[model samples]
Each structure stands twice: as C-alpha cells, then as structure tokens.
Target: MRNDPLLSIKGLRVEFPTQDGPLVAVNNVDLDVARGEVLGIVGESGSGKTVLGLSAMGLIDRPGRLTAGQVVFDGQDVTKYSESGWRNIRGNRIAMIFQDPTTSLNPVQQIGAQMIEALQSHRDISRDNARQIIRNAMVRVGINSPDERLNAYPHQFSGGMRQRVVIAIALLNEPDLIIADEPTTALDVTIQAQILRDMRRLSRDTRTSLVWVTHDLGVVAQIAQRVAVMYAGRIVENGPTEKILKSPCHPYTEGLIASMPANALPGERLHSIPGGLPQLSKLPAGCSFAPRCNYAASACNMSPKLIQISSDHAVRCVSPLDGGS
Candidate 1:
C-alpha cells in the first residue's frame, strides 16, 4: 500500500561486549519512517542515536551487534542481510552521510574519483555517465562550477563545501532512504542553515525518506517533521515536531525543550537539566532519567511502558508533565 512506511525498526537491541558485561546501546527501540518523511532523532552524546542509525543501515561492526529486532525496508526484512546483501542495499536503497566529511572522504583521491567509485559500486553505469550524474548532483546542492570542483581533492574545498560534496554523493544514488548523522554540526551557523535548506529541498524533490540524527533542537525545528527524544539507550518521547516542541510530555523532553536558546528571554538565565546522562552499563533500576527528573514520583521507582498520549504522541514516563494521558 502507498501508506506503508518506507522503513520500520521494531524491538531493535544493539549491544557491545564490555568487561562489565553486555553494554546495551539501543534497547527495544521502535521507529517508522514513511516515504518522503523527515524524522529527527535527538539526544545527548552516547544516547544510542548514532548506533541506532548504523544498525538501520546494516553497518554495525565487531563488538557491536543487533541482538534482536526487525529492520524492514520497503517490505523486505534487511535485519538478517549478509555482507553482500548489504552491499547492494546500502548505497543503492539506503545511504548515509556522516558528521565529518573530512574523514569520510579520502584526502588522496580527487572528489570526482571518489564520487565515481561510489556510484559505480552500486550501479552498473559507465564512468562517463556517473560523472554527469555527480556533476548534476553537485549543482543541485548549490556548489558553483561543479565540473571544476569535481576535479579537485577534498582538501581543496572548505568545511561547508566538503560537506556539500558529501551530500551530493548521498543524493547521487537516489537512494530511497538517507541516514544523516549530524551532517551540519561541524559547520558554522550560516553554513548549517544553507546545508539544511539544500537537503530539505533535495529530499522533497526526490521523495526520499530521511533520518536526521542530532543533539541540536534548533536543527530539528528547521528540518524534521517528527522528532524522537532518546535517553540512556531508549526513546523517552516522540511525536509531531510542533507538539513535541511546544508541549513536551516527558521530563527529559521538557528539559531539552526548555534548554533551547530560542526559549530564553533577553538576559534571562538559561534553563538546564541538572545532572548528566547516566552510564548505560550501570543504569538505574527504574527509569534511566528518574535521577535527574524534577517531577519524579513514587511510581517512577518502576520503569514505565511507552504510553500513547495522543494518536501519534507517545511518552515513556510514569509521571508525564501537564497531566498527560
């Protein structure tokens, strides 16, 4: 059906073997992303957002493994895909744009060479045809003189420009889904805005599903249609962007929203959630966030299941703010 989600992750549990024991990075996480939709996963560092994205792309490497879950893409289960199987689906059906283009791209290779290799790896197109596609993609991403730029090495470009090239490579394959893990975080405010705008336009034009992972709420406001707040290896809250931003239910979500720079008045002291993220390996017996929660009640001593507050809004908290249902 046309209504089916483009990607679905159910009961995803990714773990790593540590001396302490199995360190769970993502625990029973569930998410759905429809075609042409922009879903943002926001959380502090080590909250498992990056791990979850890698798992979705079948890129989880040694020491880290998906213990249980189903990753269905376009009606096919890719959770159990072999290495070769992933090779076909990775760049062809789903692509990834990492946080740092400087490291993701090779310094010795020319930009054109890398782009051509990426294209030819997944598609059977000739080098000449791939060159044309890469040129057009660079132009679409707002790079001037794409032909000349393509011939240059990654070091020749500026930080923002290199990121643009990375974006271009992700779009070159016209993949159905793109997982961008904080692609704009390394850039300045102006460059961040420009890159986000280009990506938004391109994804909409191509009807590609996007999963944007970041810790910046401002970035999510600019690009995401829906937002998921992750904490200590689990999603504590998720809902439409507008509702989640304006009426956060969970204490963690409330803290995140309150801490945004835009919410503060002139010269007013900024609000911040007390305490740091708890260690995942030694998480509390109840909710992981209960230690820092301002409104923790007696019921919070026990973990609460994700409860639906509305048709599309859910929060994993025993005592949600504003008397949420």
Candidate 2:
C-alpha cells in the first residue's frame, strides 16, 4: 500500500430519520485507500459496509444523510461538494460498481450504447471515440467480442456477463477510486473468481484504488491487500489482510473467521456467530458486540475507542484478543 492515501474518510456517520428515532447506519468511522491498493470492507448484511461506501461517493440519498465526517479524495473534502461538484468528481474521478447488474444496467439500452453514454457523460468524446474506449474497457474486463457484445441488450447476457458489463462501464472513466459493493455476489463461484482476478489485475495495471465491500471474507482474501471488519455500523478491526485473517483481534472478527467453511474440520458443521445484528435505532451502549461476545465484562458496557494493537492493526475492543493494553 502507498504511504499517501488517495481516499480518506474520517469520523463518518450516516443516519436515517425514523418515526421512533434516527437510525444510525454508519457510526463514527475512519478509512483510507491508497493509490493502486485494494481495500476490502467485510461484514454481514446491514453492517453499514454498503452505507459507508455510498457515503464516500456522496450518494447517501435523502431520508439518509451524512450526519458527520469528511470524505476526502485527492485532498478535496467531497462531503461539502454541491450536486454539480459531485458530478465533476463522481463517475470521472471516482466510480462505483453496485451489486446486481440487472439494476445497474438499462434493460432497454444496448451494452455499447450504455457504455458510450457513461464515457461521454464525463468526457467530451465523439461516438466513434467513445465506442473505442468502451470496447477497450469491455475487453479489459474479459468480455469477448467487444463489438458484437456492444450491440446486445443487458438481458441478452448471462448474470456474470451483465456484471462484466457493469464493471466495464465503471472502468471506462479510469477513475482514481472504485467502490465495488459485492459486485460478484450474484455470480457462481467460478465466474466470481474470474471477475475478482480481472478486477485485481485492472486495479494494479491502472493504479486505481479500490474499496471492495462484501460479506464474503473469501472474496477479500483473494483481492484485498488490507481489510476492515465492520459490525453494527462501526469498524471493529482494521489491518493487513494476512494479519487480520490469521490473528483477528476483535471478537466479531474472530467469529467471522472461525465461521468460514475453510476453517471447519472435515465433516464438522461450520460455526456461526451466536446472535443476529442489533437494530440500528436500538443499539446497546458500549461495545455493540458485547452482548454476543464470550469475553464480555463490566468494561464492555462502555464504548471502547478503536485502539491500535500493532503499528498497522487496530481494534475497537476493551480487551482485544491481540493483547494490546
């Protein structure tokens, strides 16, 4: 990872107004993505990983608001940008590949036309030039017969192929940062692996920073250089991927790793975390994971600040398993 981060998020908090109360989807969070680096944000559904990614892109729609924090990209705080300002940065300097290609692509539009529109929206390019750029992007994402595929509608392609098209569109601008929210979850394992490999190669070759948000740690292990584990809207652990996987410090992190199929003994049932995630609006005080944690104690009743356990590893737990004091 580069020393100078290309994207930085500090004290980010996203919330939705509710009749009962404000539902905090993303608690105070800090994150960074360096140029040419792939950072994975991993957690179960409703863990705020997706909300966090959307907040970074300035896409948290009304009803949902960025209550606090700064999303700084390339030295500019984007949280303060106007709609027009966001237009200049979003899709040009930063792009996002959302899950479900069916939703991302226009069913009525030809693949080539959609890609061309995306390219032209950000760059003043002619039809022929835009087509060429789109074609190249398609090829980069492992789409075959770029010319032929361009003329095809989204529904004409399979699930994996449609996702490839979405990825191609996101890469057409060659943005500095790409936030992918579980883009491959809909594909079969084989196709998912292929796309992951292609994405990693593309990021490395283009020097684009990538933030991959997903529930699958397996996906993260394959593509990310670093990992941030989220739970109940806050990051519980952050560190190098190898270290996080091999020696998770937070209880939630440990539970996630222990529950992975690879960690199970042959013929043994996969482990699972004991409790479902708490409601955002009704989250308990202190460590949110404490209620489900085996090591919970009196100190866990008070919120624990994220403390550095190692030079590069941090965990938000009063009694981090890594032995930090």
Candidate 3:
C-alpha cells in the first residue's frame, strides 16, 4: 500500500431497506487505491461490487444508505459531504464509467455536443476550446474522424463506439480517479481488449487511480495491478494480481480461478463452485463462503477477519491455502 493512497475506504457498509429487513449490500469493507494504481474488484453478481463502487462515488440513492464507514479521497472524508459538495467532486475530481453506454449517453443529443457539455460543466471553458478537447479525447479513444463523428447521435454509433464516447466523456475533466463498473462486459472480446489497453495506458499517463469492478478474472489479470476477491459483500482476499492469480489464499478465490475457462483442459469439463451466494439478511453464523468451501472446517463456523499472510497479501479465512493458521 502507498503511504498516501488516492482513495481509502474504511469499514464501509451499504444497506438497503427491503421487505424482509435491512439487507447489507456492502459489509465492513476496507480498501485503498494508490495513485496510478489499478485495483480490480472481482466477484459474482450480487456480491456488492457495484454497490461498493457507487458508494465510492457517493451515488447510493434513496433506500440504499451508506450506513457506516468513511470514504476518504485524497485525505478528505467524503461521507460527510452534502449533495452540493458531492457535485463539485463528482465530475471534477472523480468520474465513473458504467456498464451500459446507451443508458449513460443521451440518444437525442449529438456525441460532440454531449462531450462538450460534460467538459464545460466542470471547467470554465469556451465552447470552441471544449470542442477541441472533445475531439482530442475522441481521437485518444481511437474514434476516427472525430470532427465528423461528433455530429452523430449515440444511436448512430456502434456498441463499441458508444462505449468509447462514454470513456471519452469520463476522462474529459481529467479526474483523479475513475471507477469502471464492468464497462467492457457488453463488448466483444476484441473491443474489450482495446478498451482495457487504452484505459491502462490512460491511467499510467495521467497518474489516475482506477477501481475496476467485474465478474471476470481474466479482465483483472490483464489490467489490474492488485486484485480484491469479494464474496457475500466482503473481501475474502486481496493482493498483487500475480500473487492472487498464481497462489490464491482464500477458498473462494481459488474456486474462482479454477472456474476460469483459460484454466480448463481441452475436452475436459469446466470447474465450478457448488452452491450460490447466501442471502445477506440471512447469512450463516460464521463465514459466508463456508457452505460452499470444500476445505471448510468447524473453525470456519466462527467468522474470520482479514489477516495478513505476507507483506501485502491478506485473506479472511481460518485456514488459508497459503498454510496460514
């Protein structure tokens, strides 16, 4: 971890009021993203990855409250920020690229106009200057003939091009941090690769921190410097991407890696973890993953806390696969 992280999340908890009860979408989670670092958050659907990202952006809406914890960005605790305060920080200091580009873009507005509006919204710039910036940003994302393309509406662009426009808009203000919530999941493999490469390059060039949320470990391996494996609203393991991929400590992390298609042998069946995620309101007494863990023991019945296994690696397990006890 860096001495001064760009974003720090401590004991964060997000809950939603449901008919049954208050469902804890994000359990007590702590994370840090250093400047120019790419931290990948990996988990199954409903594992609270998206909620965690939204919490970082201060975007949790009505009924879904940030019940606990502090989200510190650049040493300032933003949980205390009001809506107006968040407005200044949102597009100006931090930006988010969501999963769907269509929903993020305005169908009726020209792409150039939208991009120019995004830039001018955060910065006091002239229309001509903003348009130039938009054109440069579009070209940076590999959008050809940016000047001509700018006049086209979102519907006129292909799925990949729309996503590129979204990325361009997110980077227009040059925010310090970017939270991408599976932004490439909807694209084809080729498009996904291009986007990932561009994002990684952009982060490195700008020294901007990134938190990428996705269910695909392959994506994490390609782009993330560090990996956090989340399960049942908690981080089961976190460490350098190479270490997490090569020597996963948590059973859930191991299972996730094993289930990857790249790890499967030709003609052999793909591996899968048994059982599904537990209901947050009705989680087991101890570890949430104990029910599905093949190595689960009686000790697992007692909830475990995240413990350091090395200088950087951490895992929440009674018996970590790394031989920790």
Candidate 4:
C-alpha cells in the first residue's frame, strides 16, 4: 500500500572512532520513508544528514560504524547484510545520487559503457537491452538526444547535464529507493529548478521513493511530502511538510526558518542562530542543543525523547515552541 514505509530506521546511532573518542555522528535517530514518498532530511552541514542516509544504505565502513539500531528496507533487516549481501541491494534495489556527477562518474569511460555496466551488474540483461533502458532513463530525466549522449564522456556534458546523466544511471535500474544527497547543490538556480521539476515528474511516474538530503528549505518545500529536521546529530522534529514549515516546534527548526531570505524583512538584519555546532566527540553533558537554545529550561539539562505532538507531528524538546512564526 502507498501508506507502507519502504524503509524504517530505528534507534540508529553512527559513530566514528577519533583520537579523543568515538564521535557520534548520528544519535538515536528514528526515521521512515514511505513507499514512493519524497522525504526531505534537512539540517546544517555536520548535522549528520548524509551520515544517516549512508548508514541506512549500509555504506558506513570501518572507523565509522553503526554502533546501534536497525535499518529495515522492504521488511528486511539491511543492517545485518554483509558486504557481499549488500551488493545484491546497493545500486540495484537502492540507488544513491551524489551532489557532483564529475566525482561520481568515471572520466575515462563513455556514459553508455558506465550505464551498461551498472545494469549488467545486477540484472541478467544483454548490452542492447541495457542501452535501450539507459536511453529511456536519460529521456525521462529530460536529457536531449539521449542516444548520442550515451557515446559522450562525462566531461563532454555541462554541470547540469552531467547530473542528469547521473540521474539517468540511477533510474536505469528503476530502484525501489533513491537516496539523493544534495543532488541540486552544484547547479545554478535556473538549472536547479529545472532538474528538480524533472526529478519530481520522474519520481511520480516511476513510483520511486526518494530521500532527498539537503539544507535548503525552499527545495524541501517544493519536493518533499514530509520533512525531518536534524540538529546536533539527532532528529529534533519531523512531520508533514506544511506543518513543519508553518508551525515548527523545535527551536533549532525555528531558527532555521527565521534565517531564510524570504523570511527576512526588507532593510532589516538577517536572522541567525547563535553559536556553533558542538563537536560530537566532546558534546556537552545534557541536551546537545541546550547550549545554544534560548528557550532551554532546567529540564533541558538532560536529553529529551521525541514526543508525539499530533498524529503526524513529533518533536524532541522539553520546551518546544508553540507554533512559532
């Protein structure tokens, strides 16, 4: 059913062993991506948005490890999947589209070769069939002359076109889940808008679930059906997109909304949240955000569990803001 979650992450914690100690990149995070749902994971840099996405895909390696929790994909406990086991899922059942295509694509290979390789890796398909699939995906992502573009190298395309090529590859398999980590960051405003439109259209037509990780609330407003607000390595708030945008309860979320260019008054100084993010290895004792939170009270001297505020909204604050503007 459309209401069913395609992926569920419970009590997730990701840690990296540092010289000082284990740096907790993600702390007790619980999240879900419903079938064909476009869920936005939004926060400032180093708030663990990317780490949580990678961990959900079982891509966290070595010093960075999943210290706790489970990542369930399509009812399977993917957290327990071995490297070899992950191969059957990664790029096949689940695909990730990175920000920069230049870094993700091979400079030396033709686009068609790369796309064909990706298809053949998971599916028992001939090169001719794979080429047709690749061409179709490229067209779906709005790439002009998809057949000719397949012969061109990554360098032959512009920044926007390169990203489209990456999207093409991701969609070639028609994966169940697509983890797009800031996929629009490298494009200009005009190009960014166009790409986002194309992605939304394709997501709807294909019924592919998307976990779009970004710091841009504007983008979230346009693409996401639900939003998760991460702060200091944990989800401080999450709910339907309109609710999160209009009536953010978490102070950090309120600050982020206040800092938006659209939210600022003309000729007035822009709003900003005071203080820097705490270093995970040496986070203060108590709530991680208590140091910077203006409304923090005595009860905030300890971590607060996520509390249900409504059927579709939840917040993690002992003193949440009351539908702040």
Top candidate, metric lDDT: 3
RMSD of each: 1.4, 1.7, 1.7, 1.1
Worst 10 residues of 2 by lDDT: 316-325
lDDT of 1 by residue, 1-325 (tens): 3899999999999999999888999999989999999999999999999999999999999989999989999999998889999999887789999999999999999999999999999879998899899989999999988888877999999999999999888888899999999999999999999999998997788889999999999899899999999999999998998888888898898888788778999789889999998888888988889889888877888988888888999999987777333
Q: Can you give the lDDT of residue 217 in candidate 3?
A: 92
lDDT per residue as tens, model 3, 1-325: 3569999999999999989899999999999999899999999998999999999999999989999999999999999999999999897799999999999999999988888888877789999999888888888888989988989999999899999999999889989999999999999999999999999899888888899999999999999999999998999999999988988899999888889888999879988899888998888889999999999999998999999999999999998996322
Tell me, by TM-score, which candidate is best: 4
lDDT minimum window of 10 residues, candidate 3: 316-325
TM-score list, all predictions: 0.97, 0.97, 0.97, 0.98
Off by over 4 Å in 4: none
Model 4 scores what on Cα lDDT?
Answer: 0.91
Model 2, 131-178: lDDT tens digits are: 888888989999878998889999899999999989888898889999
Query: In model 3, what lDDT does residue 263 have?
Result: 93
- Residue pairs in candidate 3 whose N, alpha carbon or C atoms collide under 3 angstroms: none
Candidate 2 error regions (>4 Å): 1-3, 323-325
